[model samples]
Target: MNIWNLNLRHLRALTSIARLGSISAAAEAINLTQPAITQALAKLEIQLGQLLFERHANGMTATPAALLLAPRIERALAHIASQRVTMAQLRALIMLADHGSYATASTATALAQPSLHRAIGDLSVALKRELVDRRGKGIMLTDQGRRIVRTFRLARAELEAGLTELASLQGVETGRITVGAMPLARARLLPSAVSAFYRAYPDVRINIVEGSFQELIEPLRDGELDLMIGALRDPSPGADVLQQPLFADRPVVLGRVGHPLSLTSVTISDLALYPWTVPAPGAPLRVQWEKMFTDADVQLPNVPIECGSVITIRQILLESDFLTLLSPDQVAVELEAGWLTKIADTPEGLRRTIGITTRHGWRPTGMQNAFIQLLGEVAL
Candidate 1:
């Protein structure tokens, strides 16, 4: 169901009624007449196609639907933090924030430019804050505007999650899970888990967005992604994200199949006597690579290329005598095809923790939880 179709005020009334246990009390709390609150509940029930309350002489008791929806409504409202903002205004501002221009936002939403302008203007007045500022031919959100946009995105997620849960209770499997995947996870971990999950929940959609951690972290924080899978960072990425270690991946020194290092017992000095292609500085693999040279008291090798793409690195390794540090899983196909071979183990058995990262307090829908379980099973 499109959450935009439901009235925010009615949703508030539902939560209020559930909390207060009576229509008159809820009406008094929200400063509405009892009849108005009753009508709001009635409308909500009809829209949801579920009975929300059981009437009694003493008070109204919440039904299963209300019990399921009320907490989500409460949490969503808390994220919104204002009863004065309307859904139209929220939609307008979010579009403006995303698209960055009145004309562009109108084109994207099919909303009239004047309507979009009015909605944002009215919203700013209601919130007592200037949300957007004119800058040359374009516009930009003020800091306050950006904060509100993030909160609104989170609020929408909560409502959508509630709807997904409701659908599950009715034996309908639906909803989408957006995953942010870094290099190593994409190679094998993510694909294996996704294959198993798809077999069990064929109706659910999964979107895997591939990028480095730097490229994907903000989107994950903004509620655009359900989770990220990759090597964990030392000193956790931030207080807002939680990492779960699935397995320890010890990287190996890799080169072309007939490289000199592959034919003999390799030492750190022997490994350092060649040009290397490694991840950009500050990457987990790069840090480990640096530490290997540091421990050996050998000068770092001449790195002609700073790269993160395994496919490109593989091509470079196959065509030239270059070495790189990588998880064996990342190049499993090439290893099996004789296109690449392990030159040596990373010195001293240095290993990186491969894991899943998610919002610190995220509550996954049942389908999302099931997928996470599958990831753990595959890792084992």
Candidate 2:
């Protein structure tokens, strides 16, 4: 009666019943008898301690619990479809996805053509969808099949991570950490922290994903990223994400080493004299940049380029006299390398909180927690 002992057949039965809205229809979909479908539903309800459907004269109506549980069931199925799907099957699908042909997949996996097709057939059943379709001599994944493949890959990664965690607990050398890096952190804090982390855990793999706030936040919420390091947004970015402040960061004017403005003490008016590169509209940095100008009673200078790319900005600054406003940490390396020079700190003392943003209710694994501790040490 344990829910954990629930089998794929029972879950599929429930899914079919909920979708088709009848025990008879569900039975036909899975090729089981109506009475068998009813028995499966009854057993599932007992184990779940809730009614999944209300039996009616015409058909079965899904209960609220069934409605709520459907998506979770789909996600769970996507993660670990069934014991029926072996590694060989996943390997076949992966090869087929890449080569776009069963014959090619057979050659790559060293599996026979029939064996590969059979494995895919079993996988399609476990996923309750047609995964492959033949167009002349070629084969391709259905839309649902493609989605299943993506979700399955993520699930496989999670499973691998679990195994790696166990190995680490047993004193084995292995682990991986995925980090989402935003502009401010990428330039200094992240690199320093990563360097320190590597010295301690060289066996652990590190992946740094760089993107703007909007690009990274969704993935963090979806559990694709362990944590994000960057300029913390004001007003608490979202209720689902929690931000921790490590230090205060303020905007500084930066220009190439020999730019005219870098040679002299500059005021707000002097800044207005040059064309500039600034963050795109609606970005947090853009808001700060505009405020700095307005506070100085200086008309905003002409911006020939609006950008968020650190690489592009650095390149443009190196080649031209166009100035830019950026967090000091963001351009720390360039300044130290003598490729860029700071004009001055924002006179109004504008500041942004620099820190980590993680999904709410997320608990970091041991090594991940250790890495976060290292980030805190470096931040201080």
Candidate 3:
């Protein structure tokens, strides 16, 4: 409770144990040895006068004390993470306000580093103590620094929003547009959209990032990515956003050369029995695969392999009997090369939709509009 004497390493160790389930796992999470983790936990318990976890055969089980503390610990971490966004936003605001573009401060004062040093110096002087402990890699955030960052991000977002709104709207769609997408789409959807957009209006600068669908939701709400595109299975449209129906896309079953299925006119049932390579659960293709076998009255055999990339899946399928399911669009090359053969009568209803989405009040730039149109053309 005493911020002056609190040890962040100990707090981090306790958080790791709560998350990773054991002292050993916690050590792995924090890059420390098991004994170091054990020592940190012991030190924390001594400071707090409470046991946070119960050692168990299965794993470390959270005590009531730990369970109550978990949410607080996670909130603290979230606060720390927000500092990164805050710092970035603060720097961006300074550049936008002064030079019109991010490159204006290119000469110096990048990413708010100078501002941070000034703030730290001011604080150290005010407190009559040295706060920043700079190391070989980077300066570690003192507890006070962490607290400052947590609050700072909220204030920064508000300030940035106002600055963005007032800073003389350039092209159109005056607010931020954050997009979330998968890796394959990096080559497919992103570049096309960016090009189609810039061609129409050169001023619509977008902040685009790539990640899995699961990782995109929080950012969407945090006002990061404006929209998300990627194949998601069994998408439960949440109350705040509407998930419009996109087109059902085509999926093909793939097998390596010399697979028994390759020689056989593999039935859906036959395809289900072999060792399979598959997309991770929740991928659009994986969902289609599960639905296909079930629709044909077949139970899915154990899939021993997981592949996230279409190219990797194709190579594995061609080299061995590893049956992989892929979107036909993604595997046109493999099918043509004879490296992969369709093992089953590629089922219906396993197609992904190419669609555009926006938040309820989301505005689109000319570029965003042009790109969405182009996506429709390519997808259709």
TM-score per candidate: 0.96, 0.63, 0.54
Candidate 1 lDDT by residue in tens digits, 1-380: 87877889899899999999999999999988999999998898888778889999999999887888888888889889999988888888888878989999999999999999999999999999889888888788999999988888878888888888878878998999999999999988899999999999999999999999999998888888989999999989899999999999989999999998899999999988999999999999999999999998999999999999999999999999999999999999999999999998875669889999998778898899999999999999
**How far out, in Å, is residue 359 in model 3?**
4.0
Residue-level lDDT of model 2, residues 1-380, one tens digit each, is 22225555677788788999999888998888988888888887877667779989999898776765554455445566564655556666766776788877778767799987888898888767898888887777888787666555544444444445445545665767889998888877888999999998898899999998889987776556889998788778789899999988778899999999888889989999999998788777888888888998889899999988888999999999999998767777888899999988896568777899997766565688889999999989
The TM-score measured for candidate 2 stands at 0.63
Model 1 ranges with Cα > 4 A deviation = none
Number of the candidate with higher TM-score, 2 or 3 = 2
Error of 1 at 88 (Å): 1.3
Ranking by TM-score: 1, 2, 3
Model 3, residue 258: displacement in angstroms?
A: 4.4
Error (Å) of candidate 2 at residue 9 is 11
Q: Against the unseen true structure, what C-alpha lDDT does each candidate score? A: 0.91, 0.78, 0.59
Ten consecutive residues with minimal summed lDDT in candidate 3? 162-171
